[model samples]
Target: MFPIRDHNPSGRTPFVTYALIAINMLVFLGYWGQFSAPGLDQFFYTWGLVPEQILSGRGGLTLITHMFLHGGWMHLLGNMLFLWIFGDNMEDAFGHLRYLGFYILCGLAAAALQIAGDPTSNGPMVGASGAIAGVLGGYLLLFPRAKVDVLLIFIVFFRIFAIQAWIVLGIWFGLQLMNGLGATQDGVAYLAHVGGFVAGAVLTFPALMRRGGVQFWRQTHGQPPHPQAKYRLAPSHIPRVPRK
Candidate 1:
C-alpha cells in the first residue's frame, strides 16, 4: 500500500514544495530522452552522486545536483507524489526558507550516508527519494495521528484506506532498513533514504520542543494543529460484468 494523500492540510500555500516539484519536473524534462543509454550513464555520472567520485575528492557539487536528477519518469513521479503529500505540512511548520534548508540538509545527509555505506562503489545514485524521505520523517514526528489515504493493490483488486501516519511511515522506514541490511546490488540507495529520514526527524526536533514536545502532541492530539481535511471518495461509474 502507498499513500495518495494526507488529511493534514497546511494553513498556507506551500510555495517551496510546489517550487521543488516544478524544479524537479523541469530538470527531468530538460534531459529526458535527450541521451542514449551510454550518454545517460555519462550524464548521471557527471551529475548524480557517485560515492567513488566523492571519495576521490571530486564531483563535490553533485551532493546538491543529484537531488534533482531522477532515473526515470516513475522515479520522478513517486518522489514528487510523496513530497506533495507530506511536504506542505512541513513547509507550514518550518516555513518556506527553513523547509528548503531542511530539505537540502537531508539530501546532504543522505549522500554522506550513502557514501559511507559503500565508499568504493561506482554506481551513480539519482532521485529525490532521499530528500522526500526526510519530509516523511518530519511529518511522522509532528503529525503521527494524521490520517493518510493509502491505495492498496492486490492482484486485480484495489482499495483505499485511511490509516494513521505513523503506521504508514513506520512500515516504510522499516522496509528501508530491512532492505538496506540485506541489499546486494539492488541499485537502490536505501541507506540514503534511511539517513535522510533520520536527519529530517533530528532536524525537526527543535520545532517539536518549541511547540512543547510531548505537550504539543497532547494539545494537537498528534494531528495537524488545525482542522483535518475531509475527503469523500466517489464511487466508480463502471458497471461490473456478470460472470458467465
Candidate 2:
C-alpha cells in the first residue's frame, strides 16, 4: 500500500516543505542530463554515501548530499510524494527553520546507521527515503489518529482506504525492521529507515512533552491541532450493462 494523502491539514503555509520539493526536483533535473554520460556514476560516487568511503573517513559530506540524489525517476517521485504529504504537518509542528534542521539531522542519523550496518560495502546509497521515514515517525507521534489515504493494489483489484497514522507508520517501521534483519545486501538501506524513524520520534519527544505529553494527545485526540478533516471517495461512474 502507498499513501496518497492525509486528512490532517496544516494550520499555516508549509513553505519549507514546498521549497524542499522544489530543490529536490531541480537537483534531479540537473543531474538527469548526465545520466547518459560517463560522469553519472562518478557523480554518485562523489556525492552519494559510499559506506566504505564514509567508514574510511572520506567523502564526509556525502551523508547530506546523498539525500538529494535518487537512483531513478520513481525513486525521486516516491520520496517526494511522502515528503509532500507528511512533511508539511511536521514543519507546522516544529516551525520552518527547526524542521529543516531536523530533516538534515535525521538524514545524517540515517546515513550513519546505514554505514554502520555495512561499513565495507562500496555501493553508493542515494534517495530521500531515510529522511522521509523520519517525518513519518514524527507524524505518528503527533497525530496517531490522523487519517491517511493509502492505495492498496491486490492483483487486478485496487482500492483506496483511509487508515490511521499509527497503523500505517507502525506497519512501515515493522517492515523496515524485519527487512533490515533478514536481508544482507547493498540494495536498500532498511537500517537507515529504522534509524531515521527512531531519531525523529526521539528528537520530537521533548516537544511532545512540552505540549503536555499525554495531555496534548487528549486535547488534540491525535488529529491535527485545528479540526479533523472529512473525506469522501468519488463515486465510481462505470455504466452498468442491462441484464437479461
Candidate 3:
C-alpha cells in the first residue's frame, strides 16, 4: 500500500518540502545518463554510503550525498512521493530551517544504523528512504488520528482507502522492523528505515512535549492543528466481469 495523500493541510506553504522535491528531481536528471558509464559503479561508491568506507573514517561526505542519489527512476519517485505526502506538515510543524536540520540528522542516524548492520559490506546505499522514514515517524506522532488515503492493489483489483495515520505508519514501521530482522541481502536498506523512523520519533518528542505532551493530543485529538480536509474519489469505470 502507498499513501496517495493526507487530510491535513498546512496553514502555510511548505516551501522546504517543495524545494527538496525539486532538488531531488534535478539531481537525478543531472546524472540520468551516467547509469551506463563504465565508471558509474565507482561514482556511486564514491558518493553513496558504503558501510566499509564509513567505518574506515573515509568518504564521510557520502552520508549526505547519498540522500540525493537513487538507484533508478522508481527509487527516486517512490521517495519523492513519500516526502511530498508527509513532508509539508512536518515543515509546517518544525518550521523551514529547523525541519531541514531535523531531516539531515535523521538521515545521518539512518546511515549510521545501516552501516552498523554490516559495516564490512561494500554495497553502496543510496536514496532518501531513510530521511523520508523520519518524516513518516514525525507525522505519526503529531497526527496519529489524521486521515490518509492509501492506494491498495490486489492481483487484479485496485482500490483506494482512507485510514488513520497511526495505522498506516504503524504498519509501515512494523514491516521495516520485520524485514530488517529477517535474513536477506538486497538493495533495500530496511535498517535505514527503522533507524530514521526511531530517530524522528525521538527528535520530535521534545516538540511534542513542548506542545504539552498529553495535553497536545487532547487539544488536537491527534489531528492537524488546522481544519481537517475531506476527500471523495471518483468512482471507477472498469466494468465488473462475472466469474464462471
Candidate 4:
C-alpha cells in the first residue's frame, strides 16, 4: 500500500513543489527517447553515480546533477509519485525559495553520506529519490499527526484509510534502512535516503520551533490547513453474459 494523497495541505502557496514536478517531468521526457537497457546502463554508469569518480574528486558534481536523472520509466514514475504526494505541503511550509534550497541541501547531504559509506566504489548514483526523501522528512516534522491516506489492496479487496503521517513516513524510513542494509551495492542508495531524511528533519526544526513548537499541534488541532479530499467511486457497470 502507498499514499495516494494527504488530507493536510500547507497554508501557503506551493509553487516550488509544482515547479519541481514540472521540471522533473520535463527533464525525463527530454531524455526518455534514449531509454534502452544497455544505453541506460551506460547512462546511469556515466551520470547516475560512480563511487570511484566521487572519491577521486572527479565528476563529483554529478552528485547533484544525477539527482535529476532517472534510469527508467518505473524509476522516474515512483520518484515523481512520491514527490507529488509529499512535496506540496513542504513547499507550502517553507515557501518557494527555502523549500528549493532545502531540496538541494538534502540532495547534497544524501550524496555526502553515500560517499562516506563507500568511498572506494565506482557505481553511479542517480534519481531524485534523495531529495524527495527530504520532502517526506520535512512532511513528517510539520505534520506528524496529519492525516495521510493510504491505499490497501487485498486480493480483490480495495480500501483506503487515513493514518497518521508519522506512521507512514516512519515505516517508509524503516524500509529504506532495511533495504539499505540488505543490498546497498545493488544501487538503491539507501544511504542517500537515510541521509536526506535526516537532513530534512533537522532543517525543519527551526520552522517547527517558530510555529510555537509542540504547542502548534494543540492550536491546529492536529489537522491540515485545508479540508480533506472527498473521493467518490463511480458506479460500477458490469455487463451480464448468457450462454446457451
Give per-residue CA lDDT, model 2, range 3-59, as digits (tens): 889988898799989998998999999989878999899899999999999878799
**After superposition, which runs of candidate 4 have C-alpha atoms over 4 Å from their true positions?**
37-39, 182-185, 225-229, 233-244
Q: In order, how many clashes per candidate?
A: 0, 0, 0, 8
Provide the TM-score for each candidate, comma-separated.
Answer: 0.93, 0.91, 0.93, 0.87
TM-score of 4: 0.87
Off by over 4 Å in 3: 232-244
Better of 1 and 3 by lDDT: 1
Candidate closest to the true structure, highest TM-score: 1
Candidate 3 residue-wise lDDT, 135-183, digit = tens: 9999899899998888888898888777899999999999899999883
RMSD of 4: 6.0
* Ten-residue stretch with the least lDDT total in model 4: 229-238
Worst lDDT 10-window in candidate 3:
230-239
Native-to-model Cα distance after best TM-score fit, residue 242 in candidate 4, in Å: 40
Error of 2 at 154 (Å): 3.7
In candidate 2, stretches whose alpha carbon ends up further than 4 angstroms from where it belongs are 184-186, 231-244
Cα RMSD for predicted model 2: 4.0
- lDDT (C-alpha, whole model) for all candidates: 0.91, 0.89, 0.90, 0.82
How displaced is residue 14 in candidate 2, in Å? 0.8
lDDT by residue (8-85, candidate 4, tens digit) is 656766778778778878888987887754576676777776778877778866877888888778898889889988
Model 1 C-alpha lDDT versus the unseen true structure: 0.91
